[model samples]
Target: MDVNGRVWLIEANPKPGRTLFIKTGERKVYRTSVRRPLQYAMF
Candidate 1:
């Protein structure tokens, strides 16, 4: 559980979105990006 200097990116299931998880010592951070309706329109 010593997740220091570690960075990772992951995708959330059951929906269209992206997530990122980062950890450093006792601190942890997360970032998530959900595909916007307009953004998906191009696809």
Candidate 2:
């Protein structure tokens, strides 16, 4: 899901997809790849 978990929580489906019995807003970001990183954005 995106940064806002509140959104896209449910879709318009009468059959019902995967039921979300529980949801925790706890999230953590981490980098698992090693590469040259630049701290600047090219415009």
Candidate 3:
């Protein structure tokens, strides 16, 4: 996100082809699902 300034991203699921967690946190909101690919991140 150069336009929006420096933004860092992380990979939620380190394992490939496998989902370890999904929809983490209720307030901040975090998602990681093997079923879904387009939307998922690891902190």
Q: Write the per-residue lDDT of candidate 3 for residues 1-43, one digit (tens) a residue.
A: 3677876665555654333233233322223333246643242
Sorted on lDDT, best first, the list reads: 3, 1, 2
Q: Write the per-residue lDDT of candidate 1 for residues 1-43, one digit (tens) a residue.
A: 1379564646436432233233332223332223344465466
Q: Distance from true position, residue 1, model 3, in Å?
A: 2.4
**Local distance difference test, each candidate:** 0.38, 0.29, 0.42
Q: Alpha-carbon error at 26 in model 3, in Å?
A: 41
10 residues in a row with least lDDT, candidate 1: 24-33
How does residue 5 of candidate 1 score in lDDT?
58
Query: Model 2, 1-43: lDDT tens per residue?
Result: 5676553545445343122222232222112111112222121
Number of colliding residue pairs in each model: 0, 0, 2
**What is the C-alpha RMSD, rounded to one decimal, of candidate 2?**
14.7
Superposed model 3: Cα runs more than 4 Å off: 17-43
1 or 2, greater by TM-score: 1
TM-score, candidate number 1: 0.18
Model 2 TM-score, 2 decimals: 0.14
